[model samples]
Target: MILYIAKRLSAGIVLAVLVTFLTFLLLSTSFQDVVRTILGPSATPETVRGMMAAKGWDRPVVVQYLDWLSHAVRGDFGVSVYTSLPVGPSVLQHLAVTLSIIIPALVLTGIIATLLGVWAASRGGAADRFAQGISLVGYLVPGLLLAIGLVVIFAVQLKWLPATGFTPLTEDPSAWLRSITIPVIVLMIGGIANMAAQVRGRMIDELRQDYVRTLRTRGISTRAIVFKHALRNAGSPALTVFSLEFIQMFGAALIIENVFALPGYGSYAFNASLQGDIPVILGITAFGVLLVVVVNLLTDLVNGWLNPKARVR
Candidate 1:
């Protein structure tokens, strides 16, 4: 187990480095364009050259990447090109706001989807139809549309929750919950649409296996057989789906945050892109790469724990 985890971690580290370096190389090639955008086309050639030299854009791409990587490794991702704020701290602060909504939504999605899927797979009639119906509706409806409707009914009509803006969890717990609830629900619906069907399909296959029949003949309770044996066996695939759902949730949170007017990582990244803020963009890319690597590593570890064969594979 230890060796397996170590191997996965090493692979993740290598992947992160490769991804960041490639991103840096691609961005570096566009340095002149970025400078032109920042300084405006009216600037003289000398002024542009001076700015490039000041930012070390004239340096070798490899050297520039090394310098950035060295600082990034120390959690000093330089400063934002537009704001002059430290990129690392700013990115992390916004990331915290994004996660505040994403994490809770993920947890709720997992629990509810798993139960709904397992029950649908076991009952195999109206329960199955109902689960499929929910998934279909979730998929067919646009998330933005759903968010707007929710805001109208819950925030505008009833005034049960705030329509826009976010409150920090540290400031007021109740307000934080109210601010995040609508966004969370939007994410949950999308996540469950993907995961519940995956779980139900996997569970159905597991319950039909020969081992399940033997367990039944051995007088195991249906609940025990389903929950303990079948669910455990089905977990490896379900976990894969769950991990993928997490990545999708991260992306969806960006759009959802905009709809809700939340100040978050998505908004930060969006603004940086519009302004051609390379340092902030690079910082966000590095952080996003590392985050993806970490999530995949954790997912692999969980998979190995659930299916011993996965460790060897």
Candidate 2:
């Protein structure tokens, strides 16, 4: 297991570097001038040129990338071109807010999906059909549209919750929860459906395996046979889906955050993109690369643990 984890960690580092380099390359190649964008249309050309020179943007692309990489390695994600604040601190602050919304949604989605999937898979009639229908509806709905509908019904029509803005959890826990509830639910809807489908499929497949049949023939209780044997065996594929879904949730949260006006990394990234704040953009891109690398490493570890074969040479 140690060797497996070490190898995965090493691979994750390499992949992260590649992702960062590619993101930098693409952004640098774009036609827009980063300095001009940050300065806005009203700024004189001389001011833009001076700002670019001050930020070392006048240097060769390779030199600029190397400087950025060096700072990134030391956890200095760079200063935001627009805010003139360190990108790392800004990103970290918003990331905490985003996670506050994402973590609960992830937990709820996983639990609900797993239970619904297992229940639907275990039963073989109308209940199963109903679960399938629910999953279909969830899959069909766009996340932004779902978020809009939720805001309209729960915030506007019902007036049960605040439509937008985040309160510090420490300041007022209830307000924080109320503000984030709709976004969390919107985020989880599609995730639950997708995970439920994956879990149900994996469960059905696992049940058909010879080992599952052997366990059943040995007079094991139905509950133990399904939960202990079947579910454990199905976990390998489910973990794969879970990891992918979790990573996808961050990307999806961008649009959802925009729709709900939540101040998260996604909203910051969106604004940075619109403003062409290269430093902020690069910081966000690097953060995303790091996140993907970490998630992939975690998934590999979980996969190896669940399937001993994965840990073998």
Candidate 3:
């Protein structure tokens, strides 16, 4: 297990480095004179050139990426060209806010999906059909449209929560919850849609296996057969589905955060992109790629642990 995990981890690191280099290369080469974008159509050539020289942007692209990579390795991601603030701190702050919204949504999605899937698989009745229908619709809906509809219903009409914005948990716990609730629900709906179906299908397949029938014939309770035996058998595929869904949730948060006016990593990076702020863009891109790679690696480790054959495969 240790060796398998180590192998996965090493692969993740290499992938992260490649992603970072490619992102850096593209952003650096494409957006020439971010200073002009920063200063807006007003800055003169002399001013722009002076500013670029001051910021060491006049250097060759390779030299710039190498320098940035070295600094990024030491936890300094340079300053945000958009905000004139330290890139690392700003991105970290935004990441914290984003996680506050994303984590609860993911946890709720998992718990609810698991329960719904298990119930639907075990029962297979009207409720199961309803769940299946809901999942199908949810999987098909665009996240942006869902977020908009939610904001209109919950935030605009009902006035139960703020329409869009972010509040730090440390500032006021209740306000923080109120702020994140809408975004959470939006992301949750999409996740639950696909995840429940995944769980239901896997559980159904597990329940149909011969071992399940053997356990049932031995007078094992349905609960034990489902939860203990069948559920464990179903878990390998479920883990894979859940991991991919979580990654999707992370990507969806980018758009959702922007729609909600939340100061998340996604929103920050997005706003920076409009202004062509390369450093901040690079920071967010590198961080997001690394996050996805790490998550995938962890999922592999978990899958390997659950079924040791996976490690060799």
lDDT of 2 by residue, 90-175 (tens): 98888888889888998898899998899888885887898899899998998888888888999999999989889979999999
Off by over 4 Å in 2: 30-32, 37-50
Instruction: Report the poorest 10 consecutive residues by lDDT, candidate 1.
Output: 245-254
TM-score of each model, in listed order: 0.97, 0.93, 0.91
lDDT, residue 94, model 3: 88
Backbone clash pairs for candidate 3 read none
Structure candidate 1, residue pairs in collision: none
Q: What do the candidate models score in CA lDDT, each in turn?
A: 0.90, 0.84, 0.84
Model 1: C-alpha RMSD to truth?
A: 1.2
Ranking by lDDT: 1, 2, 3
Report lDDT (Cα) of residue 142, candidate 1. 92
Rank the candidate models, highest TM-score first: 1, 2, 3
lDDT of model 1 at residue 131? 98
Which has the better TM-score: candidate 2, or candidate 3?
A: 2
Residue 86, candidate 2: Cα error in Å is: 0.6
